[model samples]
Every structure is written in C-alpha cells, then in structure tokens.
Target: MNRTLYSGLWWLALPAVLGRLWWRGRKEPGYREHWGERLALGGPAEGQATIVLHAVSVGETRAAEPVVDALLKAYPDCRILLTHMTPTGRATGRQLFAHHGERVVQAYLPYDTGSMTRRFLRRHRPRAVILMETEVWPNLLHACARMDVPVVLANARLSERSLRRGQKAGAVMQEAARAFTLVAAQTELDAARIRSLGASNVEVTGSVKFDVTPPASALEKGDWLRSHIRAGGPERPVFLCASTREGEEVLILDAWQRLADKPAGSLLLLVPRHPQRFDEVADLVTARGMRLARRSQLDLDHAIDGADVLLGDSMGEMFAYYAACDCAYIGGSLLPLGGQNLIEACALGKPVLVGEHTFNFLDATIEAVGDGAALRVKDADALANEAARLLRDHAARMEMGARALAFARRHRGATLRTVELLQRVIR
Candidate 1:
C-alpha cells in the first residue's frame, strides 16, 4: 500500500488506537493524560521557531540525549520541540531537559494520519524533523516532504529482521525511506539496510549511546546505593540484570535458583524495562521465596543487607544502577527479544554478559565480545554460570571491566559526527 492508503488505514484505526491507549493507561497513567496531543488537537501556539525531534520511547529518548545536547549548543536561539509516542519517553524527556526551561518543549507526536500529521507540522512549524532510531512513518514523512521540511534519521539502525519486514511493507515503506534527507546509522550494516530501503543519503555515524557520559549525580547515588547494600557487612557483589522484558524474567529467576556456586551474600539488582511490570516482577521475586527490597522504599537509614534482591522500581536511575553493580547482564536477550543496551554497563567499567541474541546491537556486541569487554551466553543457564564465575573471581572481573571501559572510550565521538551530519539538513 501507498501513503494515501496508509493514512486512510490510520484514520480508520483511530478508535481502536484510542481504546488501546486507554487500556494501557490502566497500568501507566501517562498514556491517559495526553489524548489531545495524540490527535494534534492541543499544544503550544503555532509559529514558534523549533526543531522537531521524535524519540518514540524510553530507549530512543535516552539515546537522543547526546544529540539533543549537541543540538541545543549548536542552535542556542532555537527551541527544541521534542515529540514522543509513549508517556515514559515524555517523562524521560521532561526529566532530562527540565533544566533547559522553555528551550525544550515536549508534546506527544500525533498518529500518522495525514491530516493529523499535517496539523502537528503546522502547529510546531519546525525548521526540520529529526527522528531518532527507526521511526519511519509514511504519513508523517509525506507531510514533512510536502511542507518542505527536511527530515533526518539520527542514531539510526535497522536489523536484518527489521529490513526484511520493511521490504515486505513494499512501496509505502520505501516511500518513507526515500523521504529522509539523511540517515546517520549506528553501523555500516545499518547504513546498507537503510540504503536498501531507498534512503540515499545514508552515513555510518556509530551510536550516540557511546557518547553518553554518566552524570555525576547518578554516580554519587550509585555509591550511596552500594554503601547501603553493604551496610554493616562485608562487601557484596552486585549483579545487575537491567531492562529485562516479560518472559525473560522467569528464565532468569529460574536460572538464579539453579546456580551451583553463587557467591555468598551476592545481591541481584533486578530492573525491568517497563514501569508497569515492576509490581509483577516484585511478585515474581517474593513468590520465589527471595528476600526483596525495592529501590523506591530504600533510604540512607534503611539497611538492605539481608535482602537477596533489590527491585529497581523507580525510573531514570539506570546510570546509577550501572555504577552500583559489579557485573551486568543486559536483558531482553535471554528470550530472543533484541537485547537491551550493554553500552552503559561497559561505560561504567562493569563486566557485561548478554544472551546469544543481540542482533539489535549486533556490530557493537561482536566488537565488545571480541575486545573482551562483553561475553555472550547461550541461554539463561549459561548466563547464570558466567555471572557466578565473574563474581567469584576478582581478577577476572577486574580485567573484563578494564576492557569494557577501554572499549567504551574508543567509541566516544558519535555525537560529534551525528551533529555534523544534522547541520546539513537542520535549517
């Protein structure tokens, strides 16, 4: 199908889309709060000079940080009209850019109906549109093109599976692909895949995630968390399982129980990717007879020395979690979900473990594994074994952590390169 049919379909699905949003809001109230913005009905008054940056959800929003900083610095006079699809992404944007004040305005990107997108464009009057990662909407791109707004895809990546899906989407996807003024991809493979979909101005610009520096506040919080975890006891090795998806938690929890030689007083820091699943994961820990303490409930006065697991139920503390852990297992990999980012763990000089499936970050994973910065386990069982081995052996853990930090340092210029590319389009 072409752009017209795609827009028509989006329009037809409006009711069901609203229904789904309402259903999702039962768990995450942020989804329920932005109904007008979703339809391009209400937002800031039009004609503000702004740069539109679309980051779909949490990961994209986080990945967009370095670029956002660069953009703000490069264009001090212009305001950033940040747009997101999810409430978490919106919240994240708010937290990350709150200090910027009126310079960074945010709103929910409307559904990809031509009329709605057109309205959104008119309301924002963005000088250019920069879509983070792989958000290629036909109606939105078409609207941008008609309105003469240059669009760039920054920190772009397209896995083979995603490429196959795009190819299957036929002309509509190709049309959207061709609409991009530029694509700054994470790797050469990503550039090639994006090119195959008709994006002509593709460039290999590495991942912006590598350029993200751990905030000092986050690191300090991590030290405080680590101190609390070891309060009145010997130092405990903290193993962080971060950004875990739904089905993978059961496998991980089961694997945790099966570890033959888990270090004494070892702490498992379990952080689920979605906030709605925090209570569900907490229940999983309690049902399994593990002593649990939530991050939300912990304080300087509260001691969690006896707890087997620390549930990271709070948002925007991932950097602190990375800094607090001795070793980190990047989640979403254990069950064939394209694995979560291991870059943050590596940046923190923590030994990293990932399950076999990391196709989402394939090139970086391969390079990190080859450099001795990261290790890939075949399944949940192997993940537990390797993590146990690392925690038990201090020398091996330190060596791997050193390698991880070195690898992270070697990839620190993506944000600069990405900004240079964006300068060509962002008027």
Candidate 2:
C-alpha cells in the first residue's frame, strides 16, 4: 500500500523527477559517456538471455565480470544482460566489455517498484537473475518470485550496519530474501546475515572479485609505470595513494606533509574512488602548497623528479597503477567507509597499508595482516611510517608483497564456485 502510494506520488512528481535525473546526468561525467548506450538501448533483449546479472556499481560490476565471461564460454547461446544503478558502473561496463556489450546489454536498472519491476521481468524473461553484492530491491524480488524467475545473490555481502537497519526492516527484508532461490555469499559472516534475512538456501561461495583473470592490459600498465617512475632500481620509491575517499584526504595530506620534508624526487599518486571528485581532490592537493600533476599529461619517458604528487585523475586504470608501484595506501578505511578491495594491490605484489576502521573488509584484511601480507596503521603517523619503511627496505617490502601475492593466488577459484552454483539454477 505504501509503495503504491509512493509510486503514485512519484508519477505526480514527474517534472521534479525528470529535473533531478537531468541534473544527475549533468553532474556525472560517466552518465554523459554512456548516454549513447542508454539512448540506443544497445544491449541484448529480454529473451536473449538464459541468465541476467545486475551489478549496482563499478566494484560489483568488476566482481561479476569473471562470472559473466565464464558463463558466456560455457553456455554459448545464453545472452548476458548487465544492469547498473550508477553511471560509473555503466561507463566501466561499456569500456570493459565494449565488443561483447552488444551481446551483454547495458542499461540503467528500472526503478524498484512493482509495475517497473514487472515490466523489466516480462521484458527480459531471463532463466535466472544474479544480483551481485547485496542489492536487494523488495518489489523487484517479489516480481521475480511471482514470475518464477530463479534468483541468486552472487558475491553477496551484508554489512553490520545494513544488518542492524535490516533488523528494523526485518519483515520486509526477510520476505524479499525468501523469494530468492539461493544466495552465494562472499563469506560465512555474509551467509549468516543472509540466512537471518530469510534466505534458507544461502551458501558461502567466496568472493568472485578475487578470481578475475588479470586484464591483458596488465603488462602495458607495468611498462607505463616503469617508464614514468623506475622502481626496484636506483630510483626513489613511488608511493601510490590508491583510492583515497573524501574524509581520508586530510589524513593523506598529513602523510604527504611528512614526505614533503624528504629530499626531492619522490611521488604520491592520489587516486580518489570517484572520478567526479578528481578536480575537488586536486584542488585540495594544490591548496596544501604542493605541486600537482595529472597522470594523463605526464611525460612517462622522463623521470618524475621534483614532482610532489600526481592526481590519478582517471578511471578503469587502478589495476595498472597498482602493478606499477612500490606500495599503496588503500583508502576508505582511513575515513570510516569500511574499505575497498585491497586484493587488487595484493595481486600486484604491492604491500598495502590501511587505517584502523576496516569492518567492511574485516575478513580479508585480518587474514592478510595475520599472514604478514599487509600492514595496518592505527593512525596517520603509522601510515606514514609504514609507507616509508616499506619503501626504504627492499627485502621487507618484497617479503610482505610476496605474502600478499601468495594470499591472492591462494584465494583464487571463487568464480568457478559461483559459476557452478549458477548452473544449478540456469538448468
């Protein structure tokens, strides 16, 4: 009743709705980039898929890429439908799977209302639906169950905060989750939470993000990085500020503040998670009384001497940057937003440093730190100290890095497990 009333009011507020979407499109550069696909509806149709996959944003989408590729190889006739709630996810999907996108259609997901959900269900008519991460839209799930579409939650993770909130929305969340045939969660903790949300068929399948076949562009990234700043050589170590978020900026700047007193020729690459914040972060960096240079404009052939910091003002190149560095400071944890996938840095054999608040990646971080694969800094000073120590001591860095790489390789095969689970539903 409430949903119907809200949706009815939503239609009445169409003008405001359209205006908001318009402003949103303008604000997000990625939305502009993907306007062609959205306008063209360039992906596969509803009947074209035996399975449908919806990922909310870039991280979730990236995690699903391996599963999609595996499914494509296994089931030649089944088309893949990829949907995203965020423009960045759409843009990243378009770029990552450009040639195959004609088969793997991309679009903004329909709003999660009964009518819209039903329209989407009927239109796609997929054999199974995979909702990556923990995106659970109540109306959509209800529609899926009504249509008898076998739904699965792949790489599912439910945060403590979300679980507490779901406790309040307990009835609704549980009802929605019960509609799903199974949920392949990332960890035992995740599976426990999903079961609490009323998914009886829940299973822990590990995280598919860990199992991605490294992109062919990996070597090119290393080459590009080597050309710019020589590492494992006579050059001063290059420290990458990988994926720092808003609140972490001051902490990062403080880290840089200490580094400023060092002799010339060291570098800090500040890669903010969102591309929209590049200019904002860059402005902040400039205000700190340090020289800033954009990564795109760099003469990589020359050495980076006297360059204070490099604002990694681009997207889809995180893995490349990770491969081409001495070590990195993973972001989000520094602020309070749990943290992002440090496994990317680990895969590149880069020792990682994080702030104290890491409940988001609790399992992975703990395992890695326990295995000496990463360093956890309690505060800003520790972050700076660890980074400096890692940079200066080649043997110590490599040992930690080697442990990190081994940890990454050890955790491989989540994609296989996820694919195996999907086969049951698709068949």
Candidate 1 clash pair list? none
Q: lDDT of each structure? A: 0.92, 0.78
Which residue segments of model 2 deviate by more than 4 Å?
1-20, 32-47, 230-234, 259-264, 299-303
TM-score, every prediction: 0.98, 0.91
Compose the digit string of candidate 1's lDDT tens values, residues 1-427: 8777877788788999999999999999998996999899997666658999999999899989988889999998888988999999999999998999888889999998888899999888889999998899888899899999999999999999999999998999999999999999999989999999999999998999999888899999999899899988999998999999999888888899888689999999999999999999999999999989999988634769989899999999999999999999999888888998889899999999999889888889999999999999999899889999999999999999999999999999999999998898888
Weakest lDDT window of 10 consecutive positions for candidate 1: 297-306
lDDT of 2 by residue, 56-174 (tens): 99888888889889988888887788888788887788777887846677777776646767776777788888899878877778888888888898888988887887777656676
TM-score of model 1 (CA atoms): 0.98
Candidate 1 Cα misplacement greater than 4 A, ranges: none
What's model 2's TM-score?
0.91
